[model samples]
Target: MGYLEDQAAVADGLLSLYEATFDPRWLDEIRSLVGEMLTAFWDDGSGAFFDTAKDQEQLVVRPQDVTDNAIPSGTSLAVDVLLRAGMLLGEPSWTERAQRTLERLAPTAAKAPLAFGHLLTALDFHLGPVVELAVIGDPGDSQTDRLLEVVRERFLPNRVLAAGAGPGAIPLLTDRQALGGKATAYLCEHFVCQTPTQDPGELARQLDAFRAKALAS
Candidate 1:
């Protein structure tokens, strides 16, 4: 149990860093590791994963439930890893694997959404467009710090966070060069970005509005 959780922790850490760095290598590494784990842990005929490894002689039943509980399930993590790899790397196989995982869990999700939060999160990622927020500045700077905080607090789904300084305004990317002395926020949903904003309050409101519009549609 500890070993599996540790592997998941490594995957999660890699994912968090990949969001900021946008490095393709991280995506590849995650996919490879996740794929290996899935291959070893999954029950090929049942379309489920055993909570315990196959080598273990002590397990009585193979657990396939995708419950969120206090921690994510092995199957849920596989789905998440596949979904992110596909989205970030534009790999069709990864997307297909994620879809398969979701399809296997659909009945479980329909029975109880809360218990399947992680599964639903993966589903949400696939169903709705993912937004990306890029903020570039010192984490300690007041304005930049506030902007980062507001962005993080927003409950928007399927979003990626990145950091760096950049040129003029662009789509799926922010032009933060204007905030010469402070931090900036670049919000991009479905590959279209709003103009860079320096005011944290304004950014929060814009995010609220955007989320409202998104949920309504």
Candidate 2:
């Protein structure tokens, strides 16, 4: 059976893999999968993804599930994957589509928050502070490891992490270089970045402060 849920779950997992490993291959795979999902399952009139692909066996009615249950609804997972992946991969169209999906479900979600927990999570991410942390240095280096540890250990909501020896191919790492040939971390809010720092303590303090300010406001 060609179910939208299967494809959306795969895309969500791939997004996590990309975040954990920073491998562009995972991102590419997610992009392809999302493209296919949109082409095969999206309802243009409703801006929601159907449970079954349009090309699948015909049914009296094609159902679209928008509520979160034991597992997140396919559409909710799709929105989460698209939003995070778009931010990581520098793709605005994917994020826009995700936004549209949310708008389509807003009234229902607002009426029953408990029934739309997963969708609400995605909405929180969409409305939350977006932090992009880029570490520049050899991945195996101690300094780089320290910076990455700080990044991973921090409780950062709506955060994306990317590390490499140099700028590399990742959009977030573009033009990001280590200072004085030492590992450096660049923390950015929205699109504006703070000064690069090699000290893990400074990075922690900066990130904590940023999160505190966001929570306060």
Candidate 3:
């Protein structure tokens, strides 16, 4: 009730994002898992999602509201997944669910958009384009590690982070590998990709320049 709705909204945003990227595997997993997560805490009569799923074996009374200081709650993460799955998979059912969920959370965002930075970022994504980045390498390697670290510290909510080796790891990066000789970074915006960069400093500079331009627009 309290902030649970806000969390749902942000989650909707992120979900929409993941879907947009065609991560069917991720969607499949979330779709299978979220319902259980919800039932753990949800009170069927409340017409509101809870902070914790109703079925949580760990809690007596699962928290009923969302909470995130600079962002939305874990509830938001769930909602975002729902929203994004609809968009990415081109599923009307998913889209309808996301829209309904967002309608429920709209008032909160309207009343206090700043506090919900994650939700705001999601809203911004729909208005324009989002950039997706895949960083592949030893998550612990120094240079590849530094590159990923720097990217996250920046305000690039439009980007998604994945560390691994797979087809998903390709296309996104200009280079086929990351700095450690196996690591790689792929950047995409508006569904179009730019060459990936292996240089951590260059990636930072590139993102910095892009954000600066985005602000200007």
lDDT of 2 by residue, 1-217 (tens): 3788899899988877866776667867977898898899887777778999888888898888788999999889889988987887788988988899999888988889999999998998998787888898877789998998988897886787888876545788888789999999999977689989999999999899888887887
Residue-by-residue lDDT tens digits, candidate 1, 1-217: 3334445557777888765554546766777777666655666666556666666566566545558888887677777766765555446676776787788889869988889888788898888767667676654467766787787776766776655444212233343453666677777765567888888888888788878876887
lDDT of 1 at 36: 63
Candidate 3 TM-score versus the reference: 0.55
Q: Which 10-residue window of candidate 1 scores lowest in summed lDDT?
A: 166-175
Give the C-alpha miss distance for residue 197 in model 2, angstroms: 0.8
Q: Where is model 2 poorest over a 10-residue stretch in terms of lDDT? A: 18-27
If both were scored by lDDT, which would come out higher, candidate 1 or candidate 3? 1
lDDT of 3 by residue, 1-217 (tens): 2234544454454454443343436555555454444454344454445665333354666664443465456555554554444344334554454445456766887888765656555556544445566666655567667767777788765554555444442234333455446666666564455677787777887778778777777
Ranking by TM-score: 2, 1, 3
- CA lDDT of every candidate: 0.68, 0.85, 0.55
Off by over 4 Å in 3: 1-32, 35-77, 81-96, 103-122, 125-128, 168-181
- How much lDDT does candidate 1 score? 0.68
